[model samples]
Target: MAETNSSDTRILMFPWFAFGHMTPFLHLANKLARKGYRITFAAPRKAINQLEPLNLFPDFISFHPVTVPSVTGLPPGAETASDIPISLSRFLATAIDLTIDQLKSLIKSISPKLIIFDTAHWIPQVAKPLGIKTMCFKVVSASSIALVLVPARNIPTDRPVTVEDLASPPPGYPSSSVVLRGKELQTLLFVTNPFGDGLTFHERITMSMKNSDVLAMRTCHEVEGNLCDYIGSQYQKRILLTGPVLPEESKSTLEERWGNWLARFEPGSVVFCAFGSQIILEKTQFRELVLGFELTGLPFLMAVKPPAGTTTIEEALPEGFEERVKGRGVVWGGWVQQPLMLAHPSVGCFVNHCGFGSMWESLMSDCQIVLAPHLGDQILNTKLLADELEVAVEVKREENGWIPKENLSEAIKLVMDKDSEVGKLLKENHNKWREIINPKLVNEYVDKFVQSLHEVVG
Candidate 1:
């Protein structure tokens, strides 16, 4: 145990409300559980239930749920870090104060040694005065990190909108594996400093990690060694490449589900499509996607998000679209067990928004990708996963900044086409990756992460 005893080291992990943000932090909380660290994870009471299965979350770790007020303009019933809106600024303006108040009250009930946070960098402001150390547990792609800090064009500069010199070698990384795309740009934006807020915010975030203490990632160096090393040097912080923190239970369930689903199909057949949680599609756009997917003449399972901000699935769906595709497709209105869905044997390819966490999860689960990235750093991740790794194909984009139905359909067909080279290579890589990454997930990924904590507080 780190700290004074097995029961003493308590982590106060406050993840953002988006499911993507919550994914890695909770996996980390569970890892800490195996190591005997007590935890009081603070978030709205509404959000904790989705993570209920994690209740087996070891003997040492425990949850502390808080209620977020029903504020206007956010999602209805929105409660915790995982349910908050995607607007970084607006969400932060509301969430920071509420989260601090919630945490402060929770702290009165249980004081702990460390506080790990993601999304909102303002957490250090609240934790520092309390004598609690804060670790910025940002969910990022290691390749994206390398590409961002490589003395790129328009990076960290006023009036610098385009990324340049991103093709430069990622520092502390093997050059042979380093790669970037011609049109793709790296992200200089982040949770707190999305449009160059100021040197103050970046300095605050970077300074928080000046220590040799772990600046862990949601990746494993074994799979992305060059990218990992590049990040460590760029951030100037100790790097821990912990693989994607996924639900352990979901893995078993997926094996069962996939085994069953595969029974209904030939080997190497279905295509899986899902935009991660927090993506709200317009009704018109949703209808177009349905048309595209149906036209591809491939078996698919889509985890669809309901419309937010005056949009709804029923309104967006094509007339009788659900009925026509009845037995062939399954579309859900909310979050699905993503990793499990992707890893199914029947699933040969994945369509994603290029969220790094989703990308890593798909790769780890042995699913080839058909990427359709929208806003945020997803564009950056798509560049790395689609262009650099070459394990995925980019969905064609429209002049309007989104892929039309035709392009989307074409991309999926290419990725899943039995006779296409892209499909063949992706399938080969998928099997190889499944073999390579499994050992880390089961054998040593979580253990190394826990070891770092024990070393720190012991």
Candidate 2:
């Protein structure tokens, strides 16, 4: 709780309005503040409120809330990306763009030597004229970044791009070809023209990349060395590796509701499943997933919201499903303490959406993983884990990319059965990664980042 010295460097942070984006930014902010840097963290009111309870270093870190300008079609008072459907994301991006002037005013008032902004393409333009440096802080995996940034064949404007176009790699791009399939691939079409915003998602990303003075990712080279190298070489930018910028270990007590449920299971006997704040599966998809859990014959805890247009988890669940698995399964409706759940001794494997945050937490927890990636960045993240890291296995998918209950069940059983070859490898890799992604390793990266900051701004 000690105050920063008068000579402490001031840093301004602006993260895209999503829980996934904000969480990592908060982690970096706290890490920098603990090192005696004065930090100003900015986001919408909702995101700021979410960050309040997690702000461990309040003495040196301050929160600044920016009003998101309302755009037509965006739900009124929807401040972050989680509040709306994925199709409305570009509208959210446009809404964030409306706050450039307000952000510019904040920059002028604080006069920070450097600004760290995530996916906000407008920041570099505003910061340049004021002689302040800007860093584009990407919170997703480096492979995701590389995959998106890699040049691809242009689709003809006459028709919508198909899954085939996306599945194929960009000709002559550096990394091995990894592309989206099924619902994830279908979402790519909408992303191409989100809300008729003119600029595609890739275009916005490119703008942010070109405008920033440096690129900072929330992953270390040990986990993603090739992707990191490819990104830097492709962009010709100085990339700062932040060593997975993982959440600090939770020492706080768990809420009574979840704590009581977890105590019943034997050590390493439960499967912990969560798909993040934004995912909403279809009734069929949800049913298949539940059936997969049922087939495993393992006690499981799942945290998921009702799928879109549904009022409750009951509405989406198959009839008699709850009663059939009453004693062995728990379906939590809303948010729970994720880090605590993953760390629990009873949890054996994480069946997740394979978002970078969940992936890192799973790796750090020594739990094997079953990946069921949902959307953007997730497909690529799945490839990195299942294909590159060999610590996780992707759910089986049909030729058309639909995941059947049998395949999902097989994937789960494969990871949980430690006697099996794949399962043993997963546990071993998970343990090895836990050592590599230790707190000391992250601290070293932060130190390097700090040193580089002095060199860049001095």
Candidate 3:
């Protein structure tokens, strides 16, 4: 390889084939590009069009579209996890794995200073021979990594990992507050299941982290320092923090229809709920969730995907629900501008699935938080926000992980009620945290993170 100029060092970003992973990778790319570093972001060809508008620094950051070769059982044109149901994610993983040769060619041609990735565990091996350093940048919270992915969670060769094994944290795990309970333990079963070809999701991520030259997270030390430290100790690799990598302020405005709808409500009275792109609730659960919002008797705007086996949000609504909540509530099937909606003064309470990205967005906004986590990482994130930080409340769940409408209603009321002591305390704590995670502090983390990248590559 020809010697590259230090001033012209470019960083390559290749996240797993999922929107949750890819979106954060791009956010960090924007941050690095702002500091004058060029970034080459690689993702499926189809996803690039969707992600293009988010490329704020298009002059400094460019997209490389990788064609996902078809794999058995993978639906045609399903380039991302969002395109298919959760059950078929393994097929997407396999398809992404098949693109290794294309990626290797890209790496050889570009010869970037470093490659940052998650879940694509082969990156280090592929980049090492090309003289490119690799960083396994985890977009999920460090607490989730520490809780399950660390080396201490011994994978017994004699027997498969059972729910019993996940009931408590592994020995030397970082925090007691992040444990999973009841049916939530079932979510971790995917760790042991085959993700792509022969590798399980756990194997894939841990191998990526284990092989990378460095490990980093989209979090700051103030919130998860101990968890990050524990991961570092177990992996024996240096850990870099990116301080949540919050999105830059947008120049665009909320859509006029949404703006007009929200304007009808008083400030701090409307409840806005959004689960991330991946969650597709069952019909019963979907109806229960909307009914929960109605039971609160508060105006709400729910942006959710259609329920399983349903064609539209309207089809899944409980009988008489539309007429009952008619003018005060809206159940939107399509996407809504989440950050802008959260920023709207009328949106006082945010009920979210607690994905890491949404967690940061909620933390930065003025709205009171209500968590309804649907996955392993999300559950851990909920624990961090509700239990560890005490800045949010999680809705109560049954033994089967079903959230009753009454419980959801009560959780919302706990945060939205003006006179509730819990609501007051949560608001105060959230404000303090919002101040700590301000843009100034996040920029400082990015500064240090870039400095570390330079040192590693050099």
Candidate 4:
């Protein structure tokens, strides 16, 4: 390793080619760049373009765009893991692995002091032999990482990890209880399988951690301190906490169309519902969610991505459903400014998919949570909040883990109905947790992380 002054220190970031992973990497890049370290951030060109709206990176940050290599059976222009259906995501992983030589060439050209790569699993090995220091940046929560760190023997090497295997508490789990169900467990297994190319996601993450010099997580001691400590002790590696890596708030306001619409509702009277970008609800599921919203008789705003291969939410809505709920509901398509939405006074409860980004963002606000976990670590995250932390309420799901239509209204009522006992508890817990999650505390952790990075490279 070479010693360099802070002004000359350069770090390259290569997160998994998805917004959920890329956004946090970008946030950290901005933070590091702001602190006077030169940054060279790299990812698929499409993924880089996605950051344009946020203007997250300073001019000091350099962008290195990697052309996504083609994969057989993958749709043209689907460069990201989120662009295609879940089954085809593995192809994107395969394509990314094929870019190792290109990445190596970039490393040679820029000669960064360190390379920060997220979850790709193959990046660290590529950088190591070239004499570059590497750090694995986990964008997910510590609990999610802890879940994957479960010993391999428990995952059944002879076969794919079963639902039951996942539901049982992994050895050394902080709790004695199971955290995932059959359906959510299945999604976790499916998403982690290196895009279903060969190695399980957990195996790749374990190997990546083993290969990297250090691990940088997007969380802090005030939130998941125990899990972070457990991971460091179990893995025998240094962990640098990035304290949520929350980007600076956007200066622009929400688009006028929805902005004016939301103003009609009283403060704390509207439900703001959104799942993260990758979740494409099935039409049947979308209809049920809408019906649930209607049953609550509450003013609501929903933003949904049409399912893959489809163009609009109208195609998924039940017949005459839009007209029926016209005055009380507004369903918009495609992405919106999420932070602004959460900050709105009219928004009281966030009905979310429990993505770690969403979870932390919601916690940072006054909004209470109504969790409907859709995939991967979301199950564990939901459990940590609703079951263990008691700050949020889980929508009741059927035995197989599907949220029935009825559970939707019931879950919302439990969180939003002020007079209800569960609702009062949920709000109380939200307020208590929010105090602990203040910006000042998180920034202190960020300062420590920057100091640690300086120690590593100075």
Candidate 5:
């Protein structure tokens, strides 16, 4: 790396192929681009479709596409960002084998001073031998990271991770609203993780992180300083506290879109329900959720997946449910915009799975929460979001750990009750957070992160 000013560092960032992973990095990328650092953002073509538009508008940022290979265990036609299940082990091996040569070519062209990449357990080998300086961009919060570090023996591997385990505070970090789930547990406990040449992968990721020069976390200091500090100490890495990188939604447009949702509602009149893109509620469970939303009599908007072979929302829904809530409730198989929905004034509360992006947007909207976390460290996120954060309520679960219809209805009512003591506080705190998490301030941090990279590499 040649010595240069902070303005000179060129960075190559590889984000995980999921929405949660890409969102924050994009925020940082935008920030860095604004700071005059050159950024070559690389990922499987599909994984970064949302960012390509920005690249065209700014000379500082460029998209570098990599082809992810076909893995035998992955669903046919699986792209890097596809939510379909692929054998993690096989997926990592196959994809890395195909992309390594391509990545080297990209590196030769750009000669990035630093490579800040996603912290997947299966992705270290490509960077290790190239003498590329790598930083671990942990897309999840530190508290969630701590929960993921919990030992395998502590989890009940027989079923879904529960709110019960997440409620308990783990040692070595301050508590968070989120808890660890089977997904994070599974990733951590993998006996044959794929990051290394042919060995188990989790151990490799742990080792890589411990030796990393920098650790960029998707967290704001207000709620997670202690946890972040502990993480920094353990890993011997410098901490960079970057707030949640929200999707690129304009606030005025958000305000306008939300204003429309509000026109149909009275003050504090509606509930907003959505699971992140990765979730697919089983048929029976999904219907129960829709019915429960109906039972509330609250005008709502839900983002649901279209049923197989269906093109419209009406076909996927139960009879009369759509008509009864017609105009009052709107259902979309998928909406291109979500941040606008949360920021809408009529949206008084949210029922969500606690994915980092959804959780951050809900909080930023000043709405109350109804937690329904699934997979990975989300069990932890759900627990903290509802139980400890005092800003949300946890949806009740059955003995089997699923969120049942009766409980979902009851939980919604509890959070929306006019006289419920918790409702007001939750809303108040959420507003305070939104104020602190202004997009402008977050954008500055993003710029500084990139600028610093340039200085270091220059």
Candidate 6:
């Protein structure tokens, strides 16, 4: 392999076909592009259009549209995970796998020095022969990676891994606080089931970590140092950290309507709630969540998708719910500028699903954090925040995984109440972390990350 120039190296980013994954990859790409490295980001054509507006350094970064092959059982025109339900993600993975030849063609034409990817474990096989360095840049938390995906689990076993097997932490796992129990263990089923042509979701991620030339995560050593070290030891590979890789400050202000409405409340009084794009609550669960907000008797702005089987949020709302909360709350079934909302002076608390992106957003903001995690990684993230870090509170869940409205309301008040000792402690801890993860620290991590890429390429 020939040595590559540090100043002009072209990097290809091929994240898994999910907005959650793509958005983080773009945040890192923007960081790299700002440093003058050229980036070619590949995604489906429609996804490219959606991501175009977020391309901060378009002059240095370009979008490459890859055609997703038609696959049976996958919805027509569904190129990303968000378009279909979680059960059909395996078919989407199959669709992504079928694009290997297409990606190889792009690789040969671009001849980039390094390619960063997640979930597409085959990248190293294709890139090694072509003399390009491959990186498995995980967008998920390192705690989740260390807990489940490590090699000690002995994946590809003769029998499928049972929920019981996942209940306990793997050998030499870094933390005991991140364990899954009760109904949470059921979330690990996808790890054992086939996600792509011949591999399970666990295999996909482990293989990516095993085969890549470099391993990186969108986390910092300050928060997850021990977990990162554990992964490095298990994989016997170099590990790099990117300190949360938060999006640059937007020049555009919040949408005028949201801005004006939020201004109606006193400073640090309104509760802001939003789940990421992937979580669609059931009607019962949706009603419980909004009623929880109502029980708080505080102004709130909630942005979430409608319940399953319901076309609009209004149709799924509880009887007389909207009329009662009309002046004080709104349940919007659309996208909102979450970062801007958190930045709003009137917003005092954030109730979120604890997606990796949302995790960092909540941590960076001044709002009181309340977590309600839905997925496997998300649950682990909630543990990291609510249990390990002691910087947030998680809503208590029943044995069946249902969160009661009273529990949700109590969790919020624990952080929002003026006289609550738990709220004051959490606020103090969160402020300490926020100060540590400032811009200077993030820039340092990105600098070292770029240097590591050059070293790997050479």
Candidate 2 colliding pairs:
none
Give a tens-digit lDDT track for model 6, residues 1-458. 11233267799999999999999999898888877789999999999998998899787889999999999989999998888878889999999999999999999899999999999889999999888889999999998899888898765478767787787778888788888778887886657878888888888999999999989999999999999999999999989998898988888899999999999999999999998988889899999999999999889999999989999999999999999998899999998999999999999999999999999999999999999998888999999999988999999988888889999999988899999999999999999999999889988999899787768877
Q: What is the lDDT of residue 140 in candidate 4?
A: 82
* Candidate lDDT values, in order: 0.64, 0.81, 0.90, 0.79, 0.66, 0.90
Which of candidates 3 and 4 is the stronger one according to TM-score? 3
Q: Estimate each model's TM-score.
A: 0.81, 0.93, 0.97, 0.94, 0.83, 0.97
Model 5 Cα lDDT, one tens digit per residue, 332-381? 67644567666666777788888877777777776778888765556656
lDDT of 2 by residue, 1-458 (tens): 53344338889999989999999899888777777788899899988888988888898889999998889889999999899887788889889888888888998899999899877887888989988999998988887777655444354456876766666555545566355545556644543564225677766777788779998888888988777787787778889988877766666978887778878989898998999989888778888888888889999988998876787887788889899999889777789889888877888888999888998887777678999887768888888888777788999778666789899889989888868998998788877877878889888998898778777667
* Candidate 5 C-alpha error for residue 449, in Å: 3.5
Q: Mind giving the per-residue lDDT tens digits that candidate 3 earns over 126-179?
A: 999878899999999998899889888766556888888777787788688888
lDDT, residue 15, candidate 6: 96
Which candidate, 1 or 6, has the higher lDDT? Answer: 6
Q: Which stretches of candidate 5 lie over 4 Å from their true place?
A: 1-6, 54-57, 86-94, 120-131, 150-201, 247-262, 307-313, 435-455
Question: What is residue 354's positional error in candidate 6, in angstroms?
Answer: 0.6
Residue 3 in candidate 1, Cα distance off native in Å: 18
Residue-level lDDT for 406 in candidate 4 = 85
lDDT of 6: 0.90
Candidate RMSDs in order:
4.5, 2.4, 2.6, 2.9, 4.9, 2.6
Clashes of each: 4, 0, 0, 2, 19, 0
Q: Output the TM-score of candidate 2.
A: 0.93
Collision pairs in model 1: 16-81, 17-81, 17-82, 153-164
